[model samples]
Target: MKPFVKWAGGKTRLLKEIEQRLPADFDEWENVAYVGPFVGGGAVLCHMLEHHNNITRVIINDINDVLIEAYRFIQDDPGPIISGLKEMESIYNALSNEEQKQMYYTSRKTFNDMDGIDCQKIILFLFLNQTCFNGLYRENTKGEFNVPHGKYKNHRILNESNLWEIHDALQTVDILQGNFETVGRRLLREHVFFYLDPPYRPIVEKGNMFTMYDRTGFNDSHQERLKEMCDYIDRRGWHFMLSNSDSRSSDGQSYFDNLYNGYIINRIEVTRFINTYNATQRRPKEVLITNYQPPQQ
Candidate 1:
């Protein structure tokens, strides 16, 4: 569903490479299922709906609360929510610099302290995402959205047509928030296609690997656990694909090497874009690891 929110580690850029690795008779498979354990921006989910209508059901899970909330809102009340967001956008656009600053802080304060599904919570979440630095979702120890206002003042908070399309796509899917391991256990069906896009191990030099937004960073140990999980799934004969950083870090040899050494793997180069305050540090490279063997033409 176009990812209900903008996630820091989203893989919207790698959709084409990911699509290329799908099974040839993917549509013929009965009871086809798409499971994303760590569904971020849901770029893959949206892409699947647009391209692969054969998928009977989709299961999306995440550990982030705000993200789940946004997704649930879209699934249940997309029309009203989109309208509200558009109204909010208009209001936000009309505000002066000081007013915008005031709105950000006020919304942040209310969201941090409150613990209910009210208009305020949803509005605050939308406001923060629209105004936050690069639409980055960062939270403190107390689970407060703390990113500063971004430079873009005319952000599109809501797209009605897209929301309508996403809502239709979501009708055939189930959404949840929890650990990936749990998702693995609950999924009993065979021939399911799983796309695992966990947080990538950072390649930046001044790597504050553990950031406020991502408190539970995907470390070497977690990567090992993921390897084990994928192995277990492989034994069960379920088709799956995984994506991660191709380069190595202080942790170990490229994430692809450590995780999918014995499994069928393919390398695809993707153009990574980074338009932040420091624009000079952006570049692109190949991201590795996969299990699906696409048919040769």
Candidate 2:
């Protein structure tokens, strides 16, 4: 199953190593409840479903309402959504750059004014996501979508087949829109595994910062709150696995080391394509944290 959204902090690159780190008997454990407090791309969730059929129930939650609404739409009328997105993409391709900008801002304004999930709002969301720079779902202070138009003319706005596959995969899971802490409070204690991929702390002074979908950025306070929630889960005996930047630049301190001190942490070298212009900056290390100890070799 494909991810429901093109999230900024998705873990698509680290999926393989993360899978290998799991115990061989991980899937055989009965009554498994897979929980993702920050279900960005849903790549890990989809991987679990495809590989480990032992997951009895899955729960995913995100604070972004637009993302949640997209999932709901996928669950209901994926066909119409795909069709609408295709129409929008076609119209977008025919426009000049100035016209495209006009359409993007217009759709964003209409989306902000929309009260509910009417057809128009859904189309607007799809249109903006496809046209916006990097498929980013950014909003302004007043909660209006504000990302500018991207340069891509042949964007794959509607992936119908992938949407259908995701719809099928999500049929057995519960997807909700809420803060992670609120969802974590009601979780049961036994046979549960969590995968957390929060927005990574900035390596550079200004590059890695991301405005929240609703315009509220996840700052130091939010990170502290997440740490508190993770600690609570650790106390409850639930397994925890997390990934974050492993910056080794001279001027910066490692975020994972500073925040997750005294926890089981592993540093891995992962190559990521940092920019379309220069691929040299792509090779960077990332840190993975797990509550469970890996089996000895």
Candidate 3:
């Protein structure tokens, strides 16, 4: 089970590190409610659902409302999306590279204009992600989809079998849009295991890191607020393991180390696959913080 979209911070490469750090007795925990506060590409969510049968209930939340809606459309019915994507793929792949670039820009305008059928909006969302530069979902101050064309000669706009598989997997889960805090607040009484992959704090200078998932980018204050949420989860006796960028700030201060002072911080060397103009930043680092030590440890 793979993510339907290519997200910037998707955890596909770090899945091994995350799997190793899960609660030692996770398999034994029956009737578990699995919660993902920031389900970007849903790599971990799909992993949990495929490997663990103990998760009786599943809930995921994301700040991007349109992304959440696309998930919903997939969960409910993927026939329309599949058909639309097939047509788009046929048209795009037959075109020359120059024509494909022009088509990409036109689609971007239509997506940003946002005055089309609801179903078309979702279709364009997937189209842009598959063909956009580096699979980025960035927005301008006006909340526009502004990523440039990828100019690829070949495209995989439609993955029919994968879409059907994803649709089947999503049937058992509840998808939510809005703040991450709301997921725990409503399910406080349930025994939940949260795997958080919030927008990481930038490890490099401005205009380098891909932090703009939505119109309102996550800043330092938002990182502090997320730490408070993690504290709330810990206090409630809920299990959680979070992933974030591990690079230090300009002053050589460990920001996450200071924020999650009491938690167990595991620094893991990682190589990201996302396309970047600067090749030097390809091999970045990440940290995994868990409230309780994993059984493997």
Candidate 4:
């Protein structure tokens, strides 16, 4: 099972490196407590649920309301979402080329204008994703979905098989919508592990112009706050693994290296599948900071 919803900073390509660096006992330990503070597309969560049989409890939280509820509805009920997508697909395909372009913008406006969360809003959310450029989800300062329509030969808006698989994978998962700081509030001390994939700290100064998973931007302060949490996690004797950009700040020094200097910070060459400028250009360095150093591979 894989994540159906594609979001920015997803770790689909780095899953292997991430798995190897995990605590050695992760796969064997039973009755474990797992927490995902910034579950974007749940790439790690999906891997753990399918591969790690010992996890007893899982708590997945994200500040994005639409993303969190999408998980909830997918796990609890996906029939309505799928049916709505089918209707949308039919309506979109029946239009002429020009009509389709108009329809795409119209749908985007309706998606942004939606009020009061319902299955329909969720449906539009998925629809916009399918038709949006590069499947990218971006929003403006007004908390509106503003990504332009994408031109694709053929798109699959509804994937019943994958949705069902994702639904099954999330049956025992606890989904929450809130800040990342509150994630570890009620979590137990021992036998708990946290995998944090927060918004990437921009490499270039003021380079985070379009990093809008949420309108509430994650800036340097949030990065510092996350560092403090890592310190706390170590002091509390809990295990944690974090992924962030390895871009050097304007000072020509690795910012993440300084932030996570005390911990086991390992830099790995990563491939970016979705390139901002060009998809073909995708070689970059990403830092994986862990509290515990697993056995060498």
TM-score of each: 0.87, 0.87, 0.95, 0.94
Q: Which scores greater on TM-score, model 2 or model 3?
A: 3
Query: What value of lDDT does candidate 1 attain over all alpha carbons?
Result: 0.71
Local distance difference test, per candidate? 0.71, 0.74, 0.85, 0.82
lDDT by residue for model 4 (1-297), tens: 778787777888889999999898777665788899999988999888887778888999998899899999999989989889999888887777777779889888888898867898898898888888777777678999888878754567788888999988888888999888878657764688899998887666556433578788678898899888888878888889999877577888888888788788888877765564222447767789999986697
Please give, for residues 99-165, the per-residue lDDT of candidate 2 as tens digits. Answer: 8788788887788888877666777887777677877777688777777777776566777788899
RMSD of 2: 3.1
**Candidate 1: regions farther than 4 A off:** 204-206, 210-214, 249-252, 273-281, 295-297
Clashing pairs in 2: none
- Prediction 4 TM-score vs. true: 0.94
Runs off by more than 4 Å, candidate 3: 188-190, 204-208, 275-279
Candidate 2 Cα errors over 4 Å, as ranges: 96-98, 204-208, 247-253, 271-280, 295-297
Candidate 4, overall lDDT? Answer: 0.82
Q: TM-score for model 2?
A: 0.87
Q: Which ranges of candidate 4 are over 4 A from the true structure?
A: 94-96, 276-281
Ranking by TM-score: 3, 4, 1, 2
Report backbone clashes per prediction: 0, 0, 0, 0
